[model samples]
Structure formats: structure tokens, C-alpha cells
Target: MVNWFWKRKRPLTRTLRVRSRGDYGDVRRVDFAELAPEIDTYLGQAAYLQLGFFETLSDLIAPTPELSQKESLSLAAGAALLKHRALVDVIRERGDDPLDVMLPFREPLDTFRRATHGARPLETMLSVQITAGMLDDFYLALSASYGATGKQVAEILQADDDRDALVSILKDAIDSDPEWSSLLALWGRRLVGDTLLIARAALGSQALDEEEEARVDPVFTDLLGAHSRRMAQLGLDA
Candidate 1:
């Protein structure tokens, strides 16, 4: 979680904060005092202009799944932050295929980008951590409901000494909520755990926090259900 990055010039000729994050909530703390100009500079780039693509994606989502558009956007925004922020160096260190690893949730992402993101560029959107928090809350609820219990779900929040024990405590969060979980067809494995990995990083990064239990955003659940349904058409195991 280092915060010292080699300041490479941006292709867009914009200056965005190249944050060096640590394991603690140690990202370059939200420094509004020093950020306005930098954020504006990043937003001024052509990449920012491409955010209109999300509007088109929004239309593609139709009524926008079971989650409210806001909720979906929250989740999507989290996903974006994970990609752009989070434990980025480790991901890069692994030399993992970003497309294969992260883009599995493309449908939802594309839908989210189209619906939200407006004229903000990716660099600008990801520079701030508050937005990542919004997304973190959205991801925890969405991922846990898929039937992963507390023990399996513990990493979403704290770092437990006995991860196995904490996972046991987390079963409720993963098991009882059928709202979003019902839409997911859990088999023996996941074709897309990286989506959740992004969320875990967001949670650890303090970019997300949990909402009250029983707060099931129906719009999101329905959308997830729709996402699950469509997967069946391709004969892909849900």
C-alpha cells in the first residue's frame, strides 16, 4: 500500500492523482483542498467526453434490472473504482488478464456506464475515494446475497485473525438476503469472482460501507434476476 507513484505524464495531457494506497484506509485521503484543480484537469480530457457512452448503455438496460438506477450506478461506480484504484499494483503484479478477470460483468458494467458516468472521464471519476465507498456498499449486499455465509463473507469488512471463524459469523449476510441472491445461479464455482474482489478491495480501501440490513433495493434485484435469466439463453452455467 505505497502512495508513491512514478509520475508518468498522462496521455490525455491531464494531471490526475496517482495515489499510492496502503492496506489501511491509507489512500491519498480525500484532499478536497488539493484536488479540485487536478480533478478538473482530468475531467477536461477527451476520455471524460467519452462518458456519453454510458448514457447509451443506460438505454440498453431498459427499465434497469431489479436495482434502482441509482443503486446500479452505485454498484457500477464501485466496480470502476476497483479497476482504477483499489490494490492496483498487486493486480498488475499478477499480470492477470484484466479483460478476462474484470470484464466478466460487462453487461451490468456497460449498463451502468451508459446510465451514469455522464461527461466525467475515467481518470477523473476514479481519482476520488468517496465514490468508491458508494460502490462498495452496493457490491457487498449484491455479492453476499448469492448465498455466501458470514465466514465466507467476512473479508468484505474486517480483517479477521481467524478468517474461518469470522466467515462463520458472516453466513447470515450471505444466506438470508434473497433479493439480489435469488437472481444469481450459484453453482460449485464462479466465472466472475473478480467482480467481488473489486468490492472486497473497495471495502478494505474504505471506499464502501454497509447499509442497514433489510434494505433490499428491489430494482437491483430484478435487474440481477434479468441478468441471470439471460445467461441461461447462452447455455452458460449460472
Candidate 2:
């Protein structure tokens, strides 16, 4: 009888893995009727939709106090969402990591520039990307070295200063002593971050501009002509 019971019986198990903490799939489902500010629900749901998973960076590593935690999480979540959206859009277009698409096409573009000798459209694209790269670098340097305070970085970028003078200052400081290496590294990182910020800001400005249609309305017909002329001059095809 013991053998029969043991053979017939089976162990029972029950468990559920909850992947999300929120009730809404998107913005509209949130209940805004409560008297309290709904920023948590609003931001949290946006974060989940963008990331597919959510965790506070602080809590993931350390014991953060309750008072400032949510705000800090929301700030990171906002930046992450922007990154995710940009990456997804680029990946959809190129079937590769967004970095491959978004990075300034310097070497290839420079080669084409040298071969073609200052052709108009190629030059325009090169100029834009160069400016974008500079902005990205600036932001990166300031962020990593100076605590990532957006306002302070913005003030630095917005300051009216000569680029040549800044470069000279940086180079002199670097050559002055070995101790300056850390400062130089920080400066280099800020320049990279600034370049990224430039590209994204330009992307946003163009996205919002009413004049966008004036260029895109023709469906990039002239772009093909510019591209073919430039590529042919460089002896590149396909």
C-alpha cells in the first residue's frame, strides 16, 4: 500500500513571477482622480514602457534614503528612455547597434571629402557631424568629471569662448605636469558628451521644426543626386 500511494501521488507546486509593478500598459490607463500628485505613476509607467524592466540604480547597489530616491530614479528613467528610443529608431533603420548608426561617420566621410574636394552636400553632412561630435565630447567630459550637473555643463557650453583658445589652454595644461592628465582626461570626456548632446539636440530641433517639410517634402530626391555625384567623384558605388 505504501509503494502504491507513493507511486500514485505527485508533488504540487505553485508560483507566479510578477515582472511589472504598475497597473497600466500606457499613459491613459493611469487613474488621476486621487488628490496626491501622480508623478510617480506617470513617470514609472513611462519608464517601464521604454525599458521593459525598471530598477532604481541606487537600490540596485546601495541603501538609499527614502526622501530623494524616487526623484533620482525618475531622472535616470527619463535619460534612459531617451536613449532607448533613439537606439530603437536607429536599429530599425540599419539592423545594427544604434552606436554604429549614430556615431559621426568621420573616416569614411573624410576620405570621401578628400577625394571629392569640398563637394557641397557631402561637406554639409561632414560639417554637421563634426559639430555634433564636438558637442557630444563636451557633454561627456563635463558629466564624468564635474558630477553630471546638467545646468553647470550647459553653462559651460553656452559660454562665449574661442575654440582655439580653449584647445591651447587644454594642451598647455596637459604638458604642464603629469597631474594634469586626470584633468585632460576629464576635458576629453566632456567633449565627447557634448558632441552626443549636440547630435541629439539637432535631431530634436529638426524633428520639431516647421521647415522640415521644405527639405523632406521632395522625399529626398535631391539627396540621391548629391549622393551619386559625391560618391562618383570619390569612385565609390553601391
Best by TM-score: 1
Candidate 1: tens digits of C-alpha lDDT, residues 1-238: 1121112122222111112112222112221211112211221111121222223333323533434443544444344333333223223344644334443334434443333332322111221122222233233233232232221322332221121221222233235654323322332013223233332222222222234111222323332343344334223234
TM-score of each: 0.22, 0.20
| Candidate 2, residue 136: lDDT | 27
Candidate 1: regions farther than 4 A off: 1-86, 92-95, 117-133, 140-238
Clashes of each: 26, 23
lDDT of 1 at 24: 20
Per-residue CA lDDT of candidate 2, range 1-238, in tens?
Answer: 0000001111132111111112211111111111111222212222222232112221221333344444444454344445446434434443544443333332322332233221332222222223322332223222222222333433333332222222333344446665554533333333333333222222213232345434332212322333334223323331
What shift in Å separates residue 209 of candidate 2 from its native position after superposition?
A: 19
Per lDDT, the best of the predicted structures is 2
All models: lDDT? Answer: 0.28, 0.29
